[model samples]
Target: MPSGLPSALYGWPGLCCIPLKRKNTDRCPASLASLIINHHEDSKAPQLALVASILGLAASLDWKAASNLNPFEKCMEDPDYEQLLKVVTLGLNRTLQPQKVIIVGAGIAGLTAAKVLSDAGHKVTILEADNRVGGRIFTFRDGKTGWIGELGAMRMPSSHRILHKLCRSLGLNLTQFMQYDENTWTEVNEVKLRNYVVEKMPEKLGYDLSHRERGHSPEDIYQMALNKAVKDLRTLGCKKAMKKFNRHTLLEYLLGEGNLTRPAVQLLGDVMSKEGFFYLSFAEALRAHSCLSDRLRYSRIVGGWDLLPRALLSSLSGPVLLNAPVVAITQGIHDVRVHISTSLQSRSLKVLTGDLVLVTASGPALQRITFSPPLTRRRQEALRALHYVAASKVFLSFRRPFWLEEHIEGGHSNTDRPARLIFYPAPDEGALLLASYTWSDAAAPFAGLSTDQALRVALKDVAALHGPVVFRLWDGTGVVKRWAEDPHSQGGFVVQPPSLGHGDEDYDWSFPYGRIYFAGEHTAHPHGWVETAVKSALRAAVKINKHWSRVPSPEKQAILHRLEHIHVSEDVQQQEESPEGHVFVEAIPQVQEHITVETITPGKGHVHVHHQNIPSHVHEKVFPDVHGHVHEKVFPEVHGHVHEKVFPEVHGHVHEKVFPEGHGHRHMHEKVFPEGHGHGHVHETVIPEGHGPLHPGGHRQMEPGSQRHRHMHSSCKGGGGT
Candidate 1:
């Protein structure tokens, strides 16, 4: 019967016929059917190919019947595979032109982008605000006992193939992260019951549930609520159905389309630890639900999740600069310039010019950095308004495996208390328990408290769940991590609140602008997952590779090359001190560029001026005395417009001034330059034509209208060089 089909499609002769659903008989065959054929032990059989051929033949016959039996169609229904395919392509592709790419923030997204781009021959440099690598992938390990706890992200769903594949490629070991166990406890409405028995009786738990929802578990009933929405998603497609039903919040969905009693919905929220998240968009909730359903198991790295980032760091061919926070980014006609504040004693501001710039900072961190020319109004509004949920975790180490004695190897206890969830890792996890895992409203209070105060609050909640004996078992060591309190990560993860609506366009702020690009989990669909971060990284890298040929011109490259050679010496002698021990040093740039000035007002004052674009044979040095005064002669051969600026009396303030040049004149200055003070004075000059070659008589060479050149001043005590 199947002789015309490819002979390579070998499978079991057994076949089950399925009746097609017919809506019309005009072009229908009397014997319309679908076949489910069993395959043999041969794994390479062309099963799907044969099925597609049969479907094609049926379509050629003008059959009016509909069939959803195509395995390819079922799998491709969602964009998950398409996204993963892009990630895999990025991971496998290694041929590309080498370009200078500067990635802001050394988080997972930044690291992944750097890894892929660097492997493809790009010279990538990662600038991290904090001293650590992993942004939200932090891990806390006890130094003495070797116990470990995840302060940020903990679990990895088995369905996250990209993350799993990355872990394997990085040679990291993985273990089952027992997300739930039958012996786990659920406490709600002052009543506690094991998870296995919670579904048996709802009335005893004070929940007035419906007849159909009575015997179903909270997870089951949640699926039941999504049944109609899922049907709409299947029939009307994701975009149309989401547009139709996503206007409702999770709370609204449960009350309206879910058709469940209020008590039942409330019970579901309590048992599922989603009380704080009910206000989020139902569409966002559904996306999260698809990733976290019971059908997909979870896993975690063996030692700690930080190993992944560390491995990525080790794999990079470029450097990762720690404690270097990027303060500003400017997009030029040819390249992008990133300004970073160094952690050195000089507190010097460094400018890194690259072919492409990828910003992987979190939403809050991105808000802090200044952008030249300004971002689009929509992107700025999205950055200002998009919501990031608060999350806090309290980890406690126990001297003994107390929960194991109760035959509970791993799982979590859901409760209506301040600690919405308590997770117990497996025995091999060194008895370190996530005593408190709270999100959104539940985490707000914890984020404001000190570690000791947070520990006390968490202990109180744990005692309520496990009785007073838990205090005795606690090993006197606890770690509290409030993601909102973290300077790098202002909040835990991003979520589209109901107020923001359910459209994915709200998060499109990460889209590329000019030569600058954006990445991070917040910028992608299914926010707050490591997989999302990886996918976003892949996307940014692919875009960069596609648009990488827009390299800077030869003149721009020369200026950028010269900028890298400009170095500031850290040697400065201390002079007379002020009564309050205030020291201030200001910087003036040679070219019309953006300069970020940082001041360190300690006790004394000294000034050292760095002369850039000078011949290798000649150098100019300027030194200021205790009176904060310097005498210098301006270059006589200067042919450019001279714009003099005076600085006000800066006692203890740090100021940044941007002198953007339109043609050859400074039409506008971002900040106010105070009138010249006789005590400490700084002047500004913009060289229109290129500076001529430098000689021993204090002349230097520089590009015309170059934004990459800057002249820095530091306090030095001596005299001037010839």
Candidate 2:
């Protein structure tokens, strides 16, 4: 038996080796020496002899070469022996200390966090309850249509910097987005509407229109009304707006205003209340409007919105273990150990331990996670306070452009019923694409339908707008997605109910968790849109960056000042009045010591006043000095025809004596000789023989300095000219 061996090692082991004293070599089994030599040469030898000899047992055994033996060299000399020793050492080390990390979900956020941690020199394992990535962003392809449709999160506007940056970093080619212009069509009361500018209508109806135009569609009109109402409320101040309109619904408020006709109100109510399903008070609607109005307009991604999440996933530098579900998170003082189960195996669990853990799942998923210490009441209350609105999208591709066929004389009438239509010509194809949005109750019918069933209903609606809708060619490339069903995303976006009351408290509630952060359309300020997404992500990133380093708030006041100044300048420019009124010009030449009376049309034919011996260069700078005193020099007699003019005499320039045909009632024409000069032209006061005066709104041809005695005349019809 090996010296110092435990009793357990010697008593019950199946394979045992005993060391016999050299003096009692006769008792040693003959196979012992042969076994050692054969095993060593066979490269399948047990390490007992090697280890024992290295520990000074060879000296007791009187082995001559034991001192010179190199255990590592001997092991390396044989491939099988080297691998066997390596396996044993690794097994021993693993038994002493193990490593593990737990990732919460398989969605984009969870996958992203896992990939980041794994890349940063940590052993990570992802626990995904779902079978696939891209939580709410789903792509569906119909075999019949041969086109792919994005059922969820379809659009990513150009302003999505993180997404765009990731795409660039991943070397992915992004497609340019098509503008939703005239090719778009909308349906109203089952009648096809076209050529409408929905965003501009509210302004024409005496309501203030702020925010970018959303074009002509029910969505645009709804958004416009909501936006205008919000601006009106904000102008009145938040406190006052809330106090005045908090109890009223949008329908009640609009009806009270009496700004909309009954039919229009009914149509809007059907679309916004019934179809949109947004049951919001006037205050809530205004808050939502204000939030969304601050964001950039909606836009679709190049290929689809899926490109963004995929790009983020492809850029991950670590391995992502798919189908691995996390069972538990066990944390110690210094490290956290995660228990995970793989789909391939059930009995044994894989453990990953790490220093820090990040949970990126949704609110509901966060609720499901069992924290060892448990979350505090504040965190729990926050999770409960945050509510998500159910959002669903239905996309259908038609065989051809059908709405274009049913058009009146000049395309479509703006005042008529069909004016509410929204249509946009498809990029790279002649097809027409129409998209519509509905809220709460309106979303119910389409929410439960499968992709095919949704397409059928949509096509039927489309057919009703365009006569028979004969072609019936649905590419079947339709997408139906219910965001409410997603475990990671319990709903599409954050929407406040009347009960919650419109305020920032709910938003402020979600931001207090330690190290753990929330981002996405729901957490976005002012709600769902590409701008909000980018802004929210940026704000989160900034918060993280600020936590890592001390950064001072920039001099934003300067920018604000500049913006204010620009607004002031714009207001001033917009207020510039058109020169519609008339006035007379009375030129008083100091040197000549005489006044020349000339009638000036405010916005019509020019009036000429002559001053002799004036330098041309000086007059060029001083002439047309109607900048200030023109308003005071009004001549009431020719006030309807004469506008206003002030001709400042040049210091050394001379004016021609002959009066032009259009020189209205030119009198007191004078000539002045230079102080030291001799003969100078005399003032004739001759109206070029036949020319009388400048017409109020007519054209006349005359040469002030020419001696041509004939006058070419024209009469004034109105007090203006072309």
Candidate 3:
């Protein structure tokens, strides 16, 4: 049987078949069917082989898909392989190199830059000279009361867009700091002033000036004046306003130009000096008012403002080396290296090579760092020209809220003059925190005092305000972090000197060699403010991103894409237009006119005529137009009586009437009242019957009792006769 098989079955030597048989006679044809089935199965082998080969190919492709990685990791594992692969695949990695970005100072600006660069696929390293990340935002826990004391930058305004956004993203909690009511207080001059309810004082003064403004009770007029003044100031740029106001001190501006009285000047000066540093000039004060005009609505931050830096730091993927002080910077055309000292014992100096270096240190710290190729003359001059104001901030936490009880009356207490004391009544954990600041010359006296001495002086000042009550002084627990002594931050913040020159005027203060970029609150727009820090950082980041041509990460790219697509809707556009062109004017209504003329001749040979037009349903209310009356009274009384009459013509209509009943009569009434119910009667009766006619015409000549009757009737008819 095997020999009889077809030649096509020669390759299938192992082929086998089984036949089904119904009885032995029916199974006779089964053998033949089995042979035919074997031939058909043999013919289908090639097709099955093709199908198996296709499935094997698909499995190999799926394995490759599962093992694929991002370009970053691929490059890290095999740099040479990645370069070769890019050359063959996309032809892009020939000149591709990792970017390094060094950020000096681990404050908010530094952290922000680090996060931005890191997210942009750049290698970032942060060098913070201080032991901690927060530079100016120092939070200390009181040993006794266990309350937190913010010795550095504390309150953040609600308008701080970046800070507020960061806080919300971080899920931090912010608590409001409650201020005590102002009651009894003494001024810096030692004058005792009783506190009056601020809400009631304006009503009492009959002027309505808000707390922000000082003036009369009807606040509308004062507000209008302020709005106009603000509009005018805005029309003139801030720099121009500063320059315009710079020549005069606040005192001089208030008294000479602002037209403020001595008392008003003193009150405003005291408030401004206490709130800001005393070093702030009148021009600086105006600039501050302009800058903070938008931020005057809210003051707070959840979990303290320090959370801002912390949140920024958390977003940074790079290493932040705290206590690592950058002593020098060496720059090349393509690479900048920074020398940082980590510790005294190790003396380990790490060289950080970066394509860009951001120096976020204070103005004073920048002055101290040595540059390899010395900073340009222009940059050096800028550093020298910029001056940091010396400010000392002291925070005191008490066991109980004593100041709140004492100053809780109506207005802010005036006890601590020069030093404004804001009592936090129901503080976190029922603790009281007092923050005091002095600037320029006034700050010198406090510099020599220790933490304990400063606390004693501040407590004593508070005691004096509240009448010598016992202070729960934190002796060992008192913490003082003076910015003056801080190495990284040599002073509080930058203050433009009166001699610092004008707006956008190029200052020699460019970063050393232009390779190192300086940014912080001081470098921010409009000078020192928390918002400036974030804004300055963003500006610097934009410059760096532009230089690198780096594609931001997926998350950041999505954000940028979404922002670019955003546009203002038409509804908002329409609302922004001025309404002046849309305003309509209505025509005045017309009424019938009645005119009356009368002549008077007095017995003393004095003749005068008076005229008035009285309208129905309306009566003339007499008020001495004092301004016009003054000018009329300037002339001497002619013939013992200055005869002056007001004849105001309305729309070219003249109604003239004689006084003293149209006869030569002397009227002795001080005033006259029109005939009406509940009206004020004139002091004297109209020209008496016996008196001569006001005019030359006698009553009898006009008519009999009819002449006098007609005269009386006409007089009464003219004035809605009683």
Candidate 4:
């Protein structure tokens, strides 16, 4: 009846089954029913419908002729499906050759490099400065209230597939991070307003400012201006756009070429800068927006964002030494020696030598280490060319939800006050509040402030926001996070400036030195994102594997092919398609139960599945199991021969032997029509008035290993309703 199955099918974790929408329709193996039923544990009605629909499609394409042929086995015999199984099995069950590899820093980049190399049969060692693993993915929780504060990287966009893969491999679940919405609050120069009003207020504010704004909504103006600017520079693509915008700041762009009235600029500046708009490289900002502005539904780990890095660390076969910060690095033609020592015994150093090394630390942490023979001029310049900004977050736990009195939902409130913005936790998730989060230069003034002083400042601003009447309702119990103030990380993460040639003397400057490599966000193309960090790490591993690797398997070859071109193009992340991953193999169940089919009757177009439409010609076939139990299957008569088999009792799921190739062919080439425009990305939400603080960790905090950028990561899908 419906064109396809419900959206709930895709939401089911670990399944890559495609939806059969109106446009771009295609048929898959008819045996997907038996395959999914066998691999998938639960036999819900939707799954059965999915199976029946697939079979219906096959039947539409002449199912009777091939019904006995077993499309599942043929689909399994497909070469691509075989290749996928090879890699997935390798990814899950490979043993390395135990070559000594040293990874400096326990950040995502370093850990990723370690995981890839170790999985390929190498001995890996990770050295981290802090006692804990996740360098910037730190989660601050109030011991008493169980409130979670993502002080560093918080939300991830759907386009960030690499990070998503790591999360899935680590067995993590993602929940949407609804930061902005129509029910948000915004404070401009002490005038408090709701987001819903701001989104609809283009007409009331001005005759001078009202030159046919897009939707006459405040968000419309901002979005239109942004879209226009992005469209203008997008021709140059993301890379060149990065160079063009890198020369100017957001303030310059909005006034000079962005073309906004002074009043409009001021209005947007108050809100945008709080989201880390000022002084940030315009190209980086625009790049972040251009690539990810579409798919707007942002999400983070269910339990805690910190759990992802922890899972990564646990996936490693080697030792992850904590508090063992790498103090110095020495490189030779054949080997690398990394000098590491704990903070308690800084002077007592232990040297661990490896055939190859990957340095995932730099900026503040890099400056702390001594490099023998010195880093190349270009590398040193690249390091110096990188900019780091102070970012501070004050987490406030209140006795009660005061904003509810104002009919304000739990989101972020934008303000021009010193506090910048305040974010409330999700609904019924308790009353822990991210009282104040300031970025870049805005964070400077509050960086050294005491927790009480920061709380007072946040309260004053909150009072200024919701009203001074509510100051007494808040009980001050919270902690402040000033990442720049930390000794390990000088200032949040690195932001790229214009004309930065991130070259090194190592491996054509990209893979770094023959014995040593650089893998961090700053070292990668898209700055300030863990995605960039992970990409850099994998890139380094690819180079290392190329230099010294064991005998290659087909699975390893596929993985190599994947890692070789992980990032799209140097210019933009768009206009190019990513290589598809294990399309159907992993999504299907590996273990299939023994199958038994009974009497067959091909239902007519008007017949329900249980109703027998085609006359059944009963003929029975018996098979004996290991338990000596006989299974008799009855089928319809076709030209005096048994016509076809019917799928009958096999408990709640499918059995393997009935359709041997069930596990391999899981995906069908079908376009999905979500409630929005389609992309390989996620949904978009209304951000005009939503109030989630930046949990940015740019290609992470613009620096890979530590820190997040000032904005939340999002993907594009063409949804304008938000």
Q: Which residue runs does candidate 4 get wrong by more than 4 Å?
A: 1-97, 202-210, 226-242, 290-295, 344-347, 405-407, 468-470, 500-509, 550-722
lDDT of 1 by residue, 240-295 (tens): 66665556788899888877788888887787765776888877776666555332
Off by over 4 Å in 2: 1-127, 141-146, 157-179, 197-277, 281-298, 325-332, 337-351, 397-425, 429-439, 450-452, 475-479, 499-504, 507-517, 530-722
- Which one wins by lDDT: 1 or 2? 1
Q: lDDT tens string, model 2, 520-622?
A: 4455444544334433333433333333223222432232232222100011112222233111111111111111222212111111232222111112111
Q: What is the TM-score of each candidate against the true structure?
A: 0.69, 0.48, 0.55, 0.61
lDDT, candidate 3, 183-228, per-residue tens: 5443455544433232123223222334544422111121222333
By TM-score, who's the top model here?
1
- How many times do residue backbones clash in model 3? 29
Better of 2 and 4 by TM-score: 4
**Global lDDT scores for all candidate models:** 0.61, 0.38, 0.44, 0.52
lDDT of 1 at 513: 64
Q: In lDDT terms, how accurate is model 1?
A: 0.61
